[model samples]
Target: MDLNSGAGSLDQFEGGDATVRGAAVVSTRLSQPTDEWFLEPLSEIRIGATEFSEPDQKLFSVTQFVTAAGRKFSVPYAVATRPARGRRLWRAKVPAAAASS
Candidate 1:
């Protein structure tokens, strides 16, 4: 468990016994082995971003995820899910002002 050491060279182990040198942060034998990681297909995609008109200040309720790729869609806040990195995709109740966008 010498984590301070650099990464291990798994490439040295070709196809034979590759399962023994699999990836695991903890020390434990896996009942079910797997060589692939991305097993599930992505359901929804995060193409772009959305911004509401300041949520109408006192008129609107909570923030929401209602826009993507410049198109508006009604997705409840609770059930909304999107993967965005840094400032690429942002969701907010307020209109996408220069500060946020």
Candidate 2:
């Protein structure tokens, strides 16, 4: 699920499976379009949309960066966009943890 920069260009990340074993979970925030926040060595992400954030007050739209072994890591923007803003991303972690939650 690619992130929307909100400026009609896609900050694309390939969709990844959450249930895969040993998947790496990463926490990320949406930055302004000018801030090309690239994940080094991680050959993933696409582009679309843009928005500007205030310098003093940084807004973090947190989301799950899920990736299983031998696959590309991705930012789950669909879940990340629930509130359309702010830090609202959550991962159930493991099945047992999900059940407990």
Candidate 3:
């Protein structure tokens, strides 16, 4: 997915599997997959010092899913880094606070 050129750019990945590099403002609810869990986009994201006008990348992470009723689950998945291009960066831990937010 091609991210928009604004703060909400990263937020666009709320329900999708993608990893966005650069200086990202990680979501408070990043570990959750529920409708209520949303990500706030970053003001700027870049590789090195070069701004990403349009980036194609991916991220890999082990994610944990929790049901509204309190059941929990985990899975490994790859998210597009720049949206529709690039390879995935791997992640291991999903913060508990992030999951419940």
Candidate 4:
């Protein structure tokens, strides 16, 4: 998905497979949107949504990044809003060993 910078301009990324395989999740909280965060490579992203009284709604997109050294960073962005913010949505990650198969 292409992530744009701003407020309330996020494209709808909901209503599909619970988990988006090979998704590019972006982070809008950095000094600049870099490939490591914006162009998230080899990441499995999950999309979620919730309604909070009328027009107020929030959508979540979560992904984890693993570096060559094995460091992991779980990044979750509120994709419902432009300039996506970070919000934790309920989810569990299957261990790499178990997911390999």
Candidate 5:
């Protein structure tokens, strides 16, 4: 299913059977408005413990711009932080292609 296509889009396949072993799932309609689109980060991200060593610091950032129902929403630098890093280390900016297909 296309994640970008919102809700009712999957209604068409509601009564379909799982007979086909390798058939692709198809949706009837898109959940979101056609005009509405997502502007996601097409680049790499990098976050290390050094960047969040301080008690209060920006750990990560995100930018998103989408238009829905004739209204526009812009999110710039959605910053987040935590008191301290846990044993589970995290890394950002890793090439997505390298990690997954």
Candidate 6:
């Protein structure tokens, strides 16, 4: 995939159907099959990122995804060409009141 920072340039990450040879825990969920997906980092791996300047121009922060069977995939950048609903989905915080309930 190819990612544009919306700063006039693009960043790219490439991966394919191969076994991810490592012992790291990660999780991902797709709101829609083709629109977007969210990656959660349960280990010391780089799951996602966010650009502080153009905060509203991001979609998802995840740079890659590795399935439970070890298949790996990647995107072009940290952000997508759409509006993100939350700030850094990978690192998002839950309200204390909501958590306690």
Q: Number of clashes in every candidate structure?
A: 1, 15, 11, 0, 5, 0
Give per-model TM-scores: 0.16, 0.19, 0.20, 0.24, 0.16, 0.20
Which segments of candidate 2 are over 4 A away from where they belong?
Answer: 5-57, 70-101
**How much does each candidate deviate from the true structure in C-alpha RMSD?**
19.4, 11.8, 14.5, 9.5, 14.4, 15.6
Q: Ranking by lDDT, best first?
A: 4, 6, 3, 2, 5, 1
lDDT of 2 by residue, 45-101 (tens): 222212233562333333323332335323332322223432212322445866699
Error of 5 at 40 (Å): 2.5
lDDT of 1 by residue, 1-101 (tens): 32123112222233445433122233233454554322221112222233333453222111222232343222212211443221212233344685598
Least well predicted 10-residue stretch by lDDT in candidate 1 = 57-66
Deviation in angstroms for 31 in model 3?
A: 30
In the predicted model 4, the residue pairs found to clash are none
Q: Give a tens-digit lDDT track for model 5, residues 7-92.
A: 12322333355221122123234587645644432221111212231464455322222222223222223244543221211112
Tens digit of lDDT per residue, candidate 4, span 1-101? 33333212222434434533343334555775455454334323222322222353544344434432344554344444443333322234567998998
Model 3: lDDT of residue 43: 31
Candidate that beats the other on lDDT, 5 or 6, i.e. the better one: 6
Off by over 4 Å in 5: 1-35, 49-101
Best by TM-score: 4
Superposition TM-score, candidate 2 onto the true structure: 0.19
Compare candidates 2 and 5 on TM-score and give the better one. 2
Q: Could you tell me how far off, in angstroms, the CA of residue 67 lies in candidate 1 after the best superposition?
A: 30
In terms of lDDT, the best-performing candidate is 4
Residue 74, model 6: Cα distance from true site in angstroms: 0.6
Location of the lowest summed lDDT over 10 successive residues in candidate 6: 5-14
Query: Which residue ranges in model 4 land beyond 4 Å of their true spot?
Result: 3-20, 28-48, 53-96, 99-101
